[model samples]
Target: MFCYKFPCGEFQTLTKMTETGITFDPPVYEQRYCAAIQILEDSRWSNQIKKVVEFGCAEMRFFQLMRRIEKIENIVLVDIDEPLLRKNSTSVDPLVSDYIRRREGPLSVQILQGSVADSSEELRDTDAVIALELIEHVYDDVLSKIPSNIFGFMQPKLVVFSTPNSDYNVIFTRFNPLLPNGFRHDDHKFEWTREEFKSWCLGIVEKYPNYMFSLMGVGNPPKDLESVGHVSQIALFVRKDFLEMQLENPLVTTPNLDDESTPYKLIHSVDYPFYVDTRTEKEKLWTEVQIELQRFKKMANLSENELDSYQETYKVPIGLILDRLHHVGATKEALLELLQENNLKIDDECVIIEDCDEESEGSDLYELSERLSQDVILTDQEHEEECWDLNQES
Candidate 1:
């Protein structure tokens, strides 16, 4: 998701130039997207792809574009930036919700906040992995590890990666004289020529003998130059072992979540069932409840006065308050019991749980339960312990 940003003055100048009909055309950006779709279309295994993971899914612009393809049931967007991840997650939630509500195929979207260089358990069992215009931003050491992580560790059936063609810098330098050396972006650590890209692909193929790759270029080069010297280069890797295994045991399936054999931690997830409208009032209430749960967890406790203050500040309707609490992991039975213990009438639809005794010393049972229910750390720890145990045994 990381990308170069021009300084304020330079950006303003660029903007002014563009507004005056002098555009800085980056053909590689659009061409890469087209190439990725075309590659998927050409693949014999395209229909078999139930899930696709996108590395460096900045702003999820490509995800929004690609999710329309009917064959993909799930898309996992991974990025290193948490704020961008959260923003994209918020942006896509309503779209996903609408898709689910309309029954337009089961399409699940997960926003993972993690590094692509690291082998993620969440990447396991996916059909394909995509990284477009991403590799040039990282140093050689990290770039070398990405292929192994994708092909050897995740072991997806297919991988589609694209990077800038350094050879095209000569053409680029013509457009902007300031970039004399022809670095596409200020943040790019290294851009590869066609031969360099091919060598790296060959190295990956050699490292994982079971996987093979194909190279292609996007965008048109000068009539004198070959297609390999185009604006962008793409590599698609297919796992031979996986294809053979699939043919042998066609009905065999991998777990959707991490299991004994696939011991990778599910670090972050946002799963939406194809029935809920996330824009509903109920959903808003649930969101508020979740926020309150986090705040209480951070403080480790909430005094009755603070609780009263929160209740007053955020005036949730009485009729749907209980239902909202239940939606956010508070058990209906426990809520009913709480009502009874306080000598309250459960049938009274107008009743809100606002009466907090000022003398009460402990966190509310509902808040405690909600906080405990979010066992993300515990789940990850258990996975790590299990992986360690398996390693020891091996």
Candidate 2:
């Protein structure tokens, strides 16, 4: 495994990997963020979500959970902590880089070092922006600029932010009598009450007519326990224009990244698994097609020259062929291309013998198919072979 070098000569590694990716923080703190991710994932406009920009993406634990949204292709992590961003970028240790390289699918993960409250060049293609458990950490001056920077300037379709509810800190005060200024973390400059948060959200939409707001809560206390509000209060701001545009036309899914310029610095970027496979797509599809053909040959007891015999050539329905291909994960679109390349017959439902020679007795469906295929076929039995204790093939 080769390691990527950084100018600082410091090594960074992504040692902690998990489905929920809760992070070093307490579960309740992380769970609030996780709930925000669930809300975005379950929202009606989720399928339209393609590119997302996450503000204050500390350690990128939340980004891992956000992958549940199937259509999300691009995730950009923006944080002012450049060293922390570099540490989580998998830019140093080979072991960590190998793990990141092995992550499956095509989601592009980018790390940027920049303050969220700046007049930075906007990533125009962003569908949604997430800023969970972030505002409380920002200084009051910087915090004031966020609504205008994110809602007015960046102008993504949706924005979801969560801040610790000061009202809910009574539950924490029971355990620790010295809960500092009713804030969950010492780093947090300030925490807000439910009403304060609601007022802030309303004021944002009033200033920027492009968006409308919704309020939700997460991490409710037990029913028997007294109500002190949720562990965190969430505000979801959706673009008013986006809702109006949907009424007149079908969703425009394709990204329009016309302004390629960006103020954010690229700290790291990684392409997940299957970006380049050892086998070409055609080769992989053809391998499955040949295996399915062999299975058909074996099951039917097809003779070498049986397809060339008299008026009726031995054959199976194209539908059945596709079904077998489906079992082995060959898509219909790929099958069409593979068949076209190999000169396979596709006449409605029937799959006829390819390059059939009427004069030659040796030309059968199995024989012709075997000759036509560019790959070697293994029996279905071999595919189902039990794994050995060691990695070596038996």
Candidate 3:
């Protein structure tokens, strides 16, 4: 009945329809955070986002996704709860901060003990501010201060806010009986319906005439159940004055922020693995290969143990490893060169240990993996720059 062209330049026709209808479970609350990241990534000013502030950073689980935005140089996390912030920021138990800090990039993270309702001189003029699942937990008096403190005073180029929708409480009650009277969390003072949420966002737009706003839902119900709206709602606001200023002067690359000020007490920080543009491209990549190859070596060792279920010939899949390396801007030639240098081999199906001996009963594979785990030495060690020139350690 319908024909469609596919990406491979092939056309397909749909001839029959299934009688069974599709079903959807209730929306997951994590969709709220995903919507925030998508909004930033797809924004018209994506290139303009060099700094972002995550106000009301609960447990900081969403911080991982924020690190992937290529342009973000600094991320500021603020939460009022001192005890909770200390635990999350500490490198000890429930290691949220430590986990997010494993990456290596030009990016740096700063954690502060502060309330969103209160304004500070250091927290002024950011590219974007994300307050997710935060406002509902504060009292009305504190909640009122957000608009003046955040939008009026700080005045970021973009702002995103999300909260639980009370209309979707019925769906939640089935899974969680102790929702504290249909609210998402026990600490929340109040959750708003879709109408109330939209009205509040509109109020911000009207109060601050220099900004524009849009509203959308996350976690829609099944096809015909349109009456039940999303379990969570998102309100995104953009600064109109700033964008107009940008249009008039396109070459102004600097954001309206105080990058040199140090009012915020620094907490956990990380540098993610990103390539640099330098003259020694090959040497730098070779050093990085020597560093990150340990991950695949351990993976191969673990695969040997599960060989009974997988193919005994060799267990690790090559495509998955390639895909991961591709993320760090590694080429296929780089991967092949690294593996060959480390005495590793791959056949048509799986990555094979060079000395994988059936007679040794997998002991050879384990030992080779252990040996490769040692520090990888670069071929051109005396070539002016040492291995540490990449500024990375295994």
For all candidates in order, the CA lDDT equals 0.61, 0.64, 0.62
Task: Rate residue 219 of model 2 by lDDT.
Answer: 63
TM-score for each candidate, following the candidate numbering: 0.55, 0.59, 0.57
Residue clash pairs of candidate 2: none
Ten-residue stretch with the least lDDT total in model 1: 7-16
Off by over 4 Å in 2: 1-26, 67-70, 91-106, 244-263, 273-394
Residue 185 miss distance in model 2 (angstroms): 1.2
What C-alpha lDDT does candidate 2 achieve relative to the native structure?
Answer: 0.64
Q: Write the per-residue lDDT of candidate 1 for residues 322-383, one digit (tens) a residue.
A: 55565556655554454455554444443333334444763353454554555455556545
Better of 2 and 3 by TM-score: 2
Total backbone collisions, model 1: 0
Q: Model 2, 1-394: lDDT tens per residue? A: 0111222332121122245421222345455555566656654577778889999988766665565354677888899998899887873112333343343345777788887886454455678999988999989888888876776556778888888888866755655563455466778888899989988887887777667777766666534443676667778877755565332223334433224223678898865543446797677777767656655655555545676544334465767778877656766777777777887777775655543453687444455455444222332222332111111211
Better of 2 and 3 by lDDT: 2
RMSD after CA superposition, every candidate:
16.5, 13.0, 12.5
